[model samples]
Structures are given as structure tokens and as C-alpha cells.
Target: MIKKLLVGIVIITALALAGVYYAIEQAKSYLQTPLALNQAELVTITPGTSFNRAIGLLVAQGWLSETPYLRLLPKLYPELTNVKAGTYQLVAPLTAYDALAQFTQGKEHQFTITLVEGSRFSEWRQQLAQAPHLTHQLTELSEAEIAAKLGVDREKLEGLFLAETYHYTAGTTDVALLQRAQRNLERVLKKHWAQRDAALPLRSEYDALTLASIIEKETAIASERSRVASVFINRLNLGMRLQTDPTVIYGMGEAYDGNIRKKDLRTATPYNTYMINGLPPTPIAMVGEAAIAAALSPEQSDYLYFVASGRGDHVFSKTLAEHNRAVRAYLKVLRNQ
Candidate 1:
């Protein structure tokens, strides 16, 4: 009976020792294993996620063993909570510790967003609705709702967001990005606003932006910015109707699709320069710093009218007769088609 009892004790001790060894070995795997993970996949996390969500993401990414280790690891290393929310590349041989470290200290995955010049807020609404990384849903949102939520009034955000590619981490807020863009516009305007020709007839920075938006819409040609701006400036100086097409298009609002109609030209809105004697109620398109500067410091010229030649370029005319002739020629070409 004594021998049997002693044998039973020895077996229990051995099993306990084996279990301890196993636990320690698993714990040490983070140090020795090489990470084998893909860089292309993005792991997106939200701000203020619960601990359970964090653990679930780890397990889903194969970063954690999903056993009690998921709970144990965080308990053992409380610093795991410091990991920032972003897209991350999960590779292998990396234990939960290493994975957590990578998330906290390593480079985050960046997403790309391109805001084009002359793009409207309604268009941005669609783009933002489809974006994957931005943590907001704008599909069902209206123009007013988006402006209110993002704090970027549609009229103001127009021609205010610079046309460029912006890189941001996953889970970036649409509002934050719009604010960032607005801030950039403010900085650029401040610098160039002072250098503007004091004798120019622009009434305010708002008026300058309004003209800049026109310049942005009339031509994509960098060389043409100063000239286009000059025409508008001359019109303002001469107290002539700006008669820009963009404003009439802006007035079309929801009716505008890909095509601009002649009937739409006669329809009037506050933005219609053909109907309004002065600057539009707001900018018609998004403008960059360069366009804004060109509006402020327009090229000195006698040109007052321009007509597109069906090409990307336009022909500038100094007098009404010259403009009418060019218009007749372009219209003739259109008729020939």
C-alpha cells in the first residue's frame, strides 16, 4: 500500500512539471519565432475600442493564439492598451508581444485620397461614402448634413480644399481631414492675401476665392491661370458682367449631370455670374494656392473674353467683336459635327 501511494505521488509531480514547461515554452515563442505575415493586408481598428475587440482583432489576424493566452497576454503586459488604431502588416514568428509592439511603435498603413480641383462637395460626399479607411458613413447624407457634421460649409469648402493627394492612417475622420484641408487653405491665403494688388477691385478674400474658383474651372492650363484671372479682373474693373459658365453650371445644382445644357444657361441662381453683376455667392470649384494667388495678383492685360476651342486651351479676345468672331468659329465647328 505504501509503495503504491509513493508511485502515485511521483506521477502527479511529473505531470505538473511537464505542464509548467509547456507554458514557459509557449511564452518564450514570441522571442524565437520569425514573423510570417503579409504586408498588403490592412488591419483597421477604431478609436475607443474595448479590450474584447482588441483581443478579437488579434485572434482574427492570427497574431494571438486565441487560447487563454489572449486574456493572459494583456494581463501580463498592460502596455498592450497603448497600441494606436491603424492598419498594420501582420507577419509571423511574431508572438503577441511582438505584434503588439509593432502596432504601437511601427509604421502604420496609410490610405490615399485625391481631392481634384473643381470637384464639388456633393461629389466629395460620394467619394467619402465609398472610402474604406475613413470611419464615417455618408451615403445617406445630404449636402447640408455633411457640411453640418464635418463643419465644412459646402460653399466654403468649395475651392478651399487644395487639389492633391492626401495620405492618412486608417480610421481617420472625414471631419478631421476636411478641417486639415481648411487649415491649409487658411495658411496659404494668409500669406498670399497680403501680396495682392491693392488697386484691384476685389472686395474681400471671399471675392478673391470666388474669382479663383472661376480661374480653376475655366482652364487646367497652368500658363492660362494669370490670363484667365486677368480677364475676370478686367471685367470687374470695367464693371462688366463676368458672364462665366461655371456659375451657371453651379446654379444647375442637382440637375447637372455630365453634360451642361443651353437651357441651364438661362436658369438663374445667386451663383450665376451671367445674371449677377458681381462675384458669385460662393466659389464654383476647388482651387489650389496657385490659383488663389493668380486671382489676387492677376496678369496685366487688356483681354476680357475667352472662348474654348474644343481643345483643352482657349482663345483670349480683347474686344466684343473679336470674341463674337471666335464664338462663331467654334459654334461653326460644333455645327459641322
Candidate 2:
């Protein structure tokens, strides 16, 4: 009787173990199975949002309303409690395990903003304000306040950021984006300044950046950047005024219309390079890497003047006489137009 009882007990234990194995397999299968949401939707997990809240949102969206995986998921993987806060693009047919993994890994949806070359700080702010998905924080702040907030120890706000496309996940603030662009400019400036050509007129990284901004505004042709840079450098070396119209326009602020008249050039302001002896007090506009490189390493040329050649390009001249003739040619082209 004892032997028969022992064998029955062993058989019961085996059955229980088999049942437990079957349950484990079923749970794994459930976690792997995809539940179609019938459509794609943007899911936002705000800062400090709990995983439970995210699951609740999923249910309220009618996607996982009847799904039991929300409860079972945490029980299986407790570490998934650390869901990141950002916007996420949730598509249908996502597996419970995969979806949970995305949250845990902070796989949020990415948004991008492009800062164009020659854009002013105000324009940068405007673009940031209009950028969708970014948390707007700089809309009401003044330039001084913005500079302080961005941790830049400068008085002026213009030309502090680099011109480039930056990508960020949603919930990123405008200040944060500006900070990133600032750091990028700093990095690029430092790197290029360190590798700069010997005996360049640039006194500091800021000076090089200022010169670069001028170069950026002077010509749109990529090949002419070095030549334009040379003109400014030569003028600086010869104690001649830069006489660039862009700087004068910048100093004019709100007063400047589309045209730069003779009076505008004659008027003296801090940023009026035509009046000022050297580089501007600050960069007039955002500068690109090419312009920065050109500023530091200008091509060897005797050319000191550049005017529009009537063909969307500039006529670079080495002498005043040549420049005057080129100006006359440009004037004739304008007259014909």
C-alpha cells in the first residue's frame, strides 16, 4: 500500500509541473502576439508619467482596452516601469514585449529643425517658436534674458548659434535646442580656431566667427567664400575700412528696408563696418562651417573689392580702378534689368 501511494504522489507532482510549464509557455506566447490598433497614433508620455498611466491611455484609446497584457507585462518585467517621457509614434500590430522595450529604451519620436545660414538670433527664436513638438520657453524672454538662460556669457544675442539641422525627441524645450546649437557652434569654432592658419587677422574665436558671419553675408557662392574672406583680411591688415554693406544694414536694426542707400552706408554705427576700423562688436548672422573655415584660412589673393557681377555672382578686383569699372558694369546690368 505504501509503494502504490508513493507512485501516485509522483504522478500528481509530474502533472502539476507540466501544467506550470504550459502556463509559462502561454504567457510567453501572449507577450509575443501582436495586437493591431487598427491605425497609427501618436502617444505622448509627459514627464513624470507613470507606466500604469501609459497603459491606461492605451486602453482609453480603444487599442488595448480589453487586453490583459498591461497587467501581466509589469508582473513579468518590472524594470519596464521606467518608461521615458516623450512623444512616441505607436503603430498597430506592436507586440507587448516590443512596445515595452521601446518605452524602456526611450525610443521616442524624433522631430527636426533646420537653422539656416545667415539667420539672425531673432529669426532663430521665431523658427524655434514655430517648431512643432518643441516646448516653447523663450517666446517671452528678451535677448539678454535668453543669453543668460542659454549660459552664454555675452551681451549680444545675435550669431550665437550654428546653422545646421538638429534632431530631438518631443518635449525638448526651445532653450534646450538653442543650447545644443550654441554648443555645436562652440565646438566648431574651437576646433577650427585651433587649426587656423598662422598670422590671420582674427584675434580670437569670436573674431573669427564675426568675420565668418560677414563672409556668409557677402557671397552665396561657395567658391567665392575664401576670396571674400581674403578681401576683409587684406583690408584689416592695410588699416582700411571693411566697407561691407551687410554690417551697416545689421546696425540699422528695424530701420533698414530692402535697400541700402548712400545715407545708410555713410551713417556710422557700432556694427557699420564701412565706418568702423575693424571687425564688428559681434557676429551679424549665423555662420556655417565653410564660412568659418574660409575666415581662418583665406586664399592668397591681392583682391580687395567685390561687387555683384549682375549674374548672381561677385566681381572680385585687386585695385580701386578695376573695382570702379566692375561697379559701372554692374550698374549698367541693373539699368538694363
Candidate 3:
């Protein structure tokens, strides 16, 4: 009787071991088998999405098809509960196990948008509204409303965001991107403001930003920024009107018809530096770091005026006569064209 009992026990143990080995082999094969995908698909996982919901999403992508294997996936691997939320690109022929691993590892897709220097805040709004996959929260909000919502007490929005390429995941809110840009601008502005040249006629950091925006619009030439900034600084010191066409254009608002008539310059408006005594109420456009530096530490020169040389550059002048000559030369170039 003892011998028979021992044989029964040994047979039961061998059967259990064979079953374990078969289950492991089947699991390996199932994990290694690639899914039937023709091309890469983009997937968005929201925050706190359950494993069941994720599986459903995979099924929606035409993979697994509610197979028993998929049903058992969560029970088989309960430790994969902390899947991150992001946009992910799933490539074709990826195995089920590999897909799960990708989710678990949080390999999210990144998108980018560039805020160009010298762009007006209105242009920034249009670009943000058109950026793909970003949650548009600023569409209906006024610039002042946006500032209030973002904890900024300012009445305007120009020059608040730094001009640069910002990378983010799909589902990031426009407000969040704006916050990043504002913080970046604050940091840079603070640093440059602290290092500014002494006895500048500018009132504050905002003054520097305002001036920088003007400088940015004045010329795109890298070497011309300081000289242009110097011209403005010299004008301010001598109590002369800025007489900048860009400011006049800004003051004209939507009424500007791509042409700056003599009447437009003569018109009095808050933003028209020709009529106003100092910097405008706010910046006219987004400014870059180079323009900011130029505003803070302008090149010391007798230049009080600048006119476009028609070569995508500007010619600086010390006197009104020189500036008039440069203007005539530019007009001649335009007529010759």
C-alpha cells in the first residue's frame, strides 16, 4: 500500500511540472508573435486611464480583437498599472508584449511649435490656435483675460512670451505652453535687466522689452541690432521723437493698408512714437534675446537715425541730413526696382 501511494504522488508531481512548462512556452510564443498592422498608428492615453480601457483602445486599433489572450493580459501582468499618459506612435508588426512594454515605458511622441521673433502677439495667437493636438483654451479669451487667467497682472500680452521653438506632448494646453514661454521670458529679462548698462533712459524692464521689440522689427540683420538700438537710445536721450515707421504702423492698427502715408506718421495715437514722447504703452511684437541684449547695452555711438539700405540692412546716421540722404538713396533703389 505504501509503494502504491508513493507512485501516485510521483506521477501527480510530473504532470504538474509538464503543465507548467507548456504554459510558459505558450506564453512566450504569444508574446513573441507580431500583430497584424499595416502601418504605424498614433495613440493617446489620457491620465488615469485604466488597464481595461487601454486594452479596449488597442482593440479599437484592430489588434487583439477581444481575444482570450488580451482578456488575460491584465490578470497576467497586474504590476503594469502605472501606464503614463501621452501621445505614442505604435509601429507596425509590433508584438503585443512589445506594445505593452512601450506603454509601460511611456515612450511619448513630441510635437513642436516655433514662435518667431518680430511676430506680433496676434500672430502668436493664430499660431497657437493652429498648432496640432494642443488643447486650445485661449481661443475665446481676450489678451487681458488670458493674462488674468495666467496670474499675470499685465493689461497687454505682447513681448511676454519668448520667441523660440517649444516642444510638448499632444494634449498639452495652450495655457501651459504660454506659461512656459512667459517664465522663460521672465528669466531672460531678469538676467539681462540686472546686467544692463548704467544711466539708461529706460524706466524699467518692461521699457527694455518694449525697446527690444522695436529693435527686432527695425532690422533682421544680426550686426544691425546694436546700431539700431543705439539710434533709439540716442533719440530718447536727446528728447527727439522716435519717428519709427513700425510704431506708426502699430498705432494705425488694422487701418494700416501695407503703406505708411505721410498722414499716417502725422496722425496722433498712443502707440505712435512720432506723436508720443516715450515708449508706447506696450511692446509691439515678440522680441528675441539678441534684441533684448541690444536694448540693455546699446552700442555707444552718435547715430541718431537709421534707414533701410535696400540690401536687407540699415545705414546708421548721426545727423538728420545723412538720414535724409540715405532715405533718398533707398527711394532711388525702390524706383529702379
TM-scores of the candidates are 0.73, 0.82, 0.85
Clashes of 2: 0
Off by over 4 Å in 3: 1-23, 33-40, 47-56, 63-81, 91-95
Candidates arranged by TM-score, highest first: 3, 2, 1
RMSD, model 2, all Cα superposed? 3.8
| TM-score (C-alpha, index-matched) for candidate 1 | 0.73
Once fitted onto the true fold, the runs of candidate 1 whose alpha carbons sit more than 4 angstroms away are: 1-39, 44-85, 90-101, 137-157, 257-263, 332-337
Clashing pairs in 1: 33-93, 34-92, 34-93, 35-92, 35-93, 36-92, 37-91, 37-92, 159-286
Candidate 2 vs candidate 3, lDDT winner: 3
Q: How many backbone clashes does every candidate have?
A: 9, 0, 0
* Number of the top-ranking candidate, with lDDT as the measure: 3
Give every collision pair in model 3. Answer: none
* RMSD (Å) of each candidate, 1 decimal: 5.7, 3.8, 3.2
The C-alpha stretches of model 2 lying farther than 4 A from their native spots are: 1-40, 46-53, 68-82, 91-97, 335-337
CA shift at 118, candidate 2, in angstroms?
A: 0.6
lDDT of 3 by residue, 199-224 (tens): 89998999999999999988888888
Model 2 lDDT at residue 313: 97
